[model samples]
Every structure is written in C-alpha cells, then in structure tokens.
Target: MNQSPLVIGARSIDVGYFNVKFTLGRPASHGGPAPVGNFPAIAPVLRSGAARHMEGVAQPDGCVVPINGVTYFVGPGAAQRGSGTDARLVKEDYATSDRYLALLRGALWRIAGDAGDAGDAKDVVIRRLGLGLPLNTYFDAAQALRDRAVGEHVVGAGANERRVTVEQARVIVQPQGTIIHFGYTNGGKPLEGVTMVVDPGGGTLDWYLSERTTPYWERSGAYPKAMLACAYAVADRLDPGWRDQPAIVDRIDRAIREQRSSFTVQGQEIQMAEHRPAVEQVLDESIDQMLTAVGKMDDVDHLLFTGGGASVFSARLQKRYPRLKKITRMDVDPIYSNVRGFQVVAEADLASAKGW
Candidate 1:
C-alpha cells in the first residue's frame, strides 16, 4: 500500500503594505481585506448583517462590520470605514491597531479553515502561528509585534455565516521570513562568503549582508520608498491631483498590484498599461538605491531577493543589472517566500517536539 503524505497544518503569515500572504504546509494564499479606497484609516466594507441592511443608506461612517463588538471594514469590498478622524491610508502602527488585529485574526481563522479538519466552534483552542516583519524593525519592535500577536483570540464571521474562534494563539518571528525560506530551498546548505539579502516590501526596502549565513546587522538598513511609492508614482502620472481623491488612489493601488490593465479615474477607466513606464521608473529608483548599498558591501557572492515589491519588479531589476546573472542568485515568488520560510521553521519546531 502506498503511504499518504502527512496532512499537518503550519502556515506563515505576512501582512505588508500591498497584501496579506498566508503560506501553509501546502500552497500559499494572499487574500485579506485591504483598505477600500484612499480614505485615511478606512477599510472597505466587509459584508455583514448591519452593512447589508444599510447598503443604500448613504452611510457617512461607511459600512461598519463589527467583530466581537469592535467595528471594522475589510479591503477590496463595498462601503468603507475610517479608523479615526486622523487615520492614515496606510498605518505604520498596524500591528497594534484594533482594526488590523481584527483583520489578522480573521485571516488566521480562514487560513486554519483552509487547513481542513476544522473543529467545531464550541471549544476555543490555541493555535501556532508564524509571523514576519520588515528588516528595518529592531529586535525589540519585532518582539513587540510578536508579543501582541500571540495569545490573541477573536470571534468573527467565517465561511457560510459561521462563527470562528481563535484562542491563545502563539506567534513567532524570523525577520523577513525570506531568510528562512532561502535556507530551506538550498537543501539546508550552509551559506558562506558574502551574501546579500534584499527584501523590498510594500512600505520599505531593506537589505543586509550575511557572512557564513549569519546576518551582519551593522550593514543593514531600510528605505521608505517601496511598492506603495511605485503605486504613488503611477497615480502621479494618471492625475497630478489624485492624492485628493481617495477612491482613485485606492483604484490605482489595486490596479498596479493586481496587474489590472486599467483603473478608474473620476468614474472613467484609464489604461494602466499606458503608464507602465512611470511605474517601472519609480520601482527602478528604489532598486537602484538598494544596488548602491549592496555595492558598498565589499564582495558579494550571492544575492537573494524576496518580498511582493521585489516580485513585482524583479524582472525589471534583473533587466537593469544583467550582472545579477554573475552571482548565485535566488528569486522565488517574492510574495510567499518569507511566509513559506516561516512555515518551514514552524514545521522544524513541530518535528523536534515530536522527535522526528
């Protein structure tokens, strides 16, 4: 008789400026609510009883979706809800925000369900979760994000109007999840010499040098110009005044990330392909800075690239620096590399506990 593969559920989750990625023992999935339009602190309306009822009521507060008595609005949906009067379109303090927490918990519950064999809703249980943060985040800050994430439980709507409870969840971090992934993909090979890890995320572009597989912390830093900036660059081309229009900004962000051929402008659809040059230009500007930094790192034998931003612009990056072919280059699906790496780390831990 043939043996079946073990059906264990271990997932790595990455919440970035562009999207929320979840990589399981199986394939990866990137879907969660993002902010609906360009409105500050407002997320798109998530479908709920109250929101459904007020669909056509011209909701000033946007459509509110309450979870555990805390209201929220998910991304890429109808209606919208603002975080606060002074909320931003993309918050740097996302890890601790109630709305963000609601989103994270909701995503985790869905990922768990995707793992299958989901238990009944009556019993609250603890689950192991893996998380990743940008390279620039200090150890203390990353720990803070992890600390806040663990032991977190939330009650919210799940598939088919079912209620989901995730309790006492534990979260761990291996900064940039991509590093873990690189190690696994290389057949657990020990990295030697100078290796440059470039992780360009939604909100930041970060890189570091590693010697013999250990990161040289002193050489690593982060830049704010990243995927979001690329979207902004595209928006600047479509309309010089687009910043004032939140919905337009939202559309541009979705269009660029989703690779939509066109985006709406003032109720009119415009071809995004026409502005491709502008997008590439903005991305090139960011990557150039990263390359400049790498050049100062003496002699690098390997270059590892991961992150949605990197995935989005890798082809262009490679094209610009054909010399990239000279190095021991590794470029996986930038979106899930980090999360998948995290999953691998979690699995190793699980295996060790079972003495495997």
Candidate 2:
C-alpha cells in the first residue's frame, strides 16, 4: 500500500492506551550532553496533551525538526454499534455510546476551554446525561459541539468524526501468537535490526526481544505490565477504601513523577512512602513469575522496558543485574515508546526496500 503512513505518540487520554513504547540508546548513552548529531532521521509524533513536551526541545537551530504526523483525538466517535456478532444490538448500545461521547466532550472542554463557538452553549441541546456531575455543564457543552457538528454553514462538520472501528487495532496487533495470545497484535514479520522493544503505559506493562525484529508496530499483545496497579494494589490492600478517595491517586502520582520513595496522601493527613526493600521483593517475585509465563529466560535477555509504568516499576528493577546495559527509556513518558519505535522500524524497512 503506497500510503503516507502515520507514527503517533499518544495524547493524555491515552495514558493507558496500547502501542506505547520504550527507547534505549546504545551503551554509554548520556543525557544533556552536547547533541551527538548522529540521531537517526526520525520524527516524533504527539497529540492532544503529550505534544507540549516535544515543543520545548525542537533543536535550537530552528531547523523545524520536520514533524510529519497527525494529531488524533480518539474520543466521542468510538463506534456506537458492535459489529460482527452484535450488529443487531446497535440500537441497544446507542445510549451507552451517547453517554460516552458526552463524557468525551466534557474532557475536551476540560482540555480546550471556552475559547469560542467550539466552546459555546445554547446551540446544542443541554440534556441530562445521568452523570453524577456537580452540574449539567457538560450537557450544555456537548450539545453545542453536536449542533455545530451537524449544523448548516459548517463544512464537513460531521465528517470530522471521532468514532473508531472495531478493526482500528489492525496495525497494533502481532500476526503471530494470535490464538494463544489474547489481545495480541496480529503479526507481521519484524524488520531486520529490530530485536529489542520496550512498551510502557498505564494499566499494564510489556516487553520482549523478538527472535527477529519485526516492525515494532506489527508486534502487539495485551500490555500487561501495570505500574499503577502494583502501587494502587498495595494501597488498596492497605486500605480497602483507597479507590474511593482521589487523594491516593494523586499521592501515588506524585511519588511516581518525583521518583521519590515517598509522597503525601490521604489529603496530606497521611504520608505514603514505599518500603523499597519490601516492595522490590514483592515486585521481583511477581516479575519472575511473569517471565516464566511469557516463555523468557533470566539470562541472555535482550529485553527493553517501555510503558507509562516503566518509571514506577524501574525503582524496583534497579537491584537487578545489568541495569546499565539492558534497561532503557524510549522517551520521557515511556508510554509512547513502542509505537514510536514501531514507526522507526517500519520507516527503516521502507527505506531499505527502495534501496535508498
């Protein structure tokens, strides 16, 4: 397919979404050193929230780092109908989809405030969405956008759809490991020189060294490594009511961001600090168990750690062997690591095929 392909780093809403990646430099990789001038000619893609980080470092030369990518806001337009087995139930899922879109608009307004007509009310029907909102503000906002979307004088308004197809993940799946690998990316062969991969994100974590480096985008599985789960699970077990309190998420989030063992929680009424030794012991035991399940050996690992959860778990991973040699950060937010690597692999393959 002669397509102008896309390589996207994720947005904020996608904190736990799939295809996030990890990047590791060769040995002797140093940060904040003078630019080495040997970085492979690759593009960085960001959308929604994550774009701001890339803007701060686009090279001082003003060379316009040549951003060739798309910014997709994957809310609202999620397909309202269930295809294949449940086509007949489309009407059943309509309300669910509408409620979801309403919530998505609420989030959008949260991101892009009342700037103009896109942010205006009155044009759209502000109805009750049944959310436990403090007020029906989003209902008012969504109605405006919905009206503007379908209204007259607005060219291709409805065409700017946000829905996703059931098959939207084709590129995110690995061809192999299908029947056995639940939610595995349907596979395509890896490009040469593509052996290592690290995929990090919220919700789950995953990594692998392929027997052969397939295009990273072509390799997919349920990213089961969750940086948040462990800590929150710890928090939950420690306090059953923790989930009900937003303070716990905030505290854990702070601990993760600062890379500190401690942070404030329980509305600052309590402090949550990791017993690193105990946490790592439990963590290591779990990783070892997962290693067995994924059919990997402890020695001779070519692994990469990529995901939003990478930083959070990396603390415990510090005591393990070859920490300097094997561990890598594909980017600041490890969640975007895999998809970006996958983009590089695909681009490299394309270049090779053309004998460039």
Candidate 3:
C-alpha cells in the first residue's frame, strides 16, 4: 500500500494596503486556535544608520528585514522613520514591488519566530501557502503573484535571518476569503443562493457575487474608492498641507475605523463629526458604483461586509441594503477575516489530499 504524502505545514497571507494579516495552520495535535498576526502595511527601506538607530529605539510592533540586499523597516512604527513617499499607496504595480515582498517576508519572519522554528537555523518549510488579491487584479496578477511567492526566501538578516520555503501557492479574489470564512465558521457548510460580499479595505473596495460558493465573475469587481480615498478627502477638508502626510492619514484611517467623533493632531482636536459629509460622500459614491456594476441583486439572499473598513462602511451599507450581514468570528477581528479564511481553505485542501 502506498502511503499518503506528509503535509509539512501551511500558511495564509493577506497583504492589504493598510495592513498585512497572516495565519499559520497548526496540526490537529496542537489542539488550540490557529496562530494569527497582523501589522501595518508600511514597509519603507531603511537608509544608512537608520537600522542602527532602530536598534537603540524600542519597536515592539515593528522589525527590520533584508530583502535582496536592501533592508526595510516594516510594520506599525515603520512609517515614522521614512518620508511620506516611502509608502507605495495607490500604486498600480504594488504587488510586484519590493515593499510588498518586505511586508510578506516580515509576516513570515514573525510567524517563524513565534513558532520557534527559526531558532534551529534551518528553513521553515510551508507545504501550502494561500494568498489574496483585489478582484480587479485577481485574473491578471494572481498567477504572477503566486509565482513570486512560491520558492525559497531568506527573510531578516544576520542573526535573525530565517529561510522560508513555500512549496505551493494559491491566490484567490480577496472578498471570496470572507465568504469562505463566513460559511466555515457559521455551520461548516458552503453558502447557498445568491450571496454578495463587499470588502472595503484601505486601497480598494472589492465585491463578489456568488451562488452556493461559485463566483459570478461578470458581476465581481473592485475599485480604488475605499478608506484611503476617504482619508484623503478628510485630509483635504482638515488641512491642505496634511494631504502629503501619511502619518496623519493613518490617524484619520484609525479614527474612521473607530468611528471617533474627533481625533487629535499636533495637540489640536479635529472633529471628525464635522467632516462626516465628506467621508460619507466618498463611501456613498463607491457603494453606488458597486451596486450599479453588480446590476440588480434582488435575488441576493445575503449581503455581507468584511475588511478593515467594514465598520466604517457598515452603517451606510445597511441603510442601502437592509439584509446586509456582517461576518463575525468569535475572537477574529473583521480586518483578519480574509487571511483567516485563506488558512482554513489551505488546511481543508491539505486534509483532502491526505484523505483525512
């Protein structure tokens, strides 16, 4: 009798414009929840003595990693060390950029460190890796992204250097991950009828129409009208000079996510409530465009929302479609919905391959 192939490990990475979310699939013997993590999407190259300076300053939420002979500061506090232009927001070729790889390697390094797999100075082998792309980029860039992700990678530098090998990779439309998560967490069954998933993230507003898990590509699409656009609009209203400040934009992004009435900037409190109209206008327009693109959805049984900007877009969406459902998983934040679902999908495939 032939033996089943051994499944080494699996990982899922969702690198959005605002954050990088990831999960590592643990074996059944581990007997605990999946290991997951996230950090800011900023990955700016470190210059000259910056890395040495970073060593002295405490950065609990950030780390430095070397990719192809260049070092980058990646994560929450990374943006503070670089100019605003360092962040490649709204770039059409973002997925193929070095910063994207920096964020990807940063996540892998953290995961390997947390798993204690990097201490042995050996490669951490991932048998399967799952990734996500905006709906608009899925068809055109998915294959290229997958090719870029699979194979050996050296993350970090010097003593912290860790080798990570991705043997296989899978890329799917970003919003589809949310639905997979909803279906798996709800009842371990696939969805039925016409279900629409709207994922509002930092860079793009992606939506998908599916019938019992089969996607309707004609109706599925993505656009650049999302949280970043709202932030820019808010910045324009608050201060024209603030338009070039990525840090200020980050604060605005957080304030919108928290639904805060006001946010403090340079010791001055800026009332977000006053600028609500500007923010809402952008969201409303995006929703209108999405609705028109998807055509009629009267047959839609469930309308779901997921992503970092979900809370910010929820109220507006609910008023438009009363049946809209929010995808919720016990301890998982909405921002992590896609990455978590990607892990679930990869693990399920591994199980099937192993005849489990």
What lDDT tens digits, residue by residue, belong to model 2 across residues 114-163?
A: 21235322122211111110011222333443332221111011312121
> What local distance difference test score does each model get?
0.56, 0.31, 0.77
Per-residue lDDT of 143 in model 2: 41
Look at candidate 1 and give me any clashing residue pairs: 33-75, 34-75, 36-44, 38-246, 177-338
* Worst window of 10 by summed lDDT in candidate 2: 126-135
Q: Report the lDDT tens digits of candidate 1 across residue range 1-356.
A: 02331233345566665555665344333222111111222344343444443555754422233655555654333224432221224445666566655555545544534444553232233234567665555454566666666653444334322233332223433334566666666667646687777777667777867776577676666666776677778877765566545556667777876788987665788888788888888787777776666556447777777665555666676788677657635465565666676666665665566688
Going through the candidates in the order shown, the clash numbers are 5, 36, 0
Candidate 3 lDDT over 1-356, as tens digits, reads 03332235678999988888888666566444466878878887787624554557775456677767778887667776666665437766788878888898888776665654333333577778889999877877888889988887777556666677788888988888888877767677766678788889989999888998788899889988899999888988878667567778888988888888888898999998888899999999999989889997777876777787877777787766666544321224577778877887787777777789
Candidate 3 matches the true fold with a TM-score of 0.88
Candidate 3: minimum summed lDDT over ten consecutive residues — where? 324-333
Quality of model 1 by C-alpha lDDT = 0.56
Task: Give per-model CA RMSD.
Answer: 7.7, 16.5, 4.4
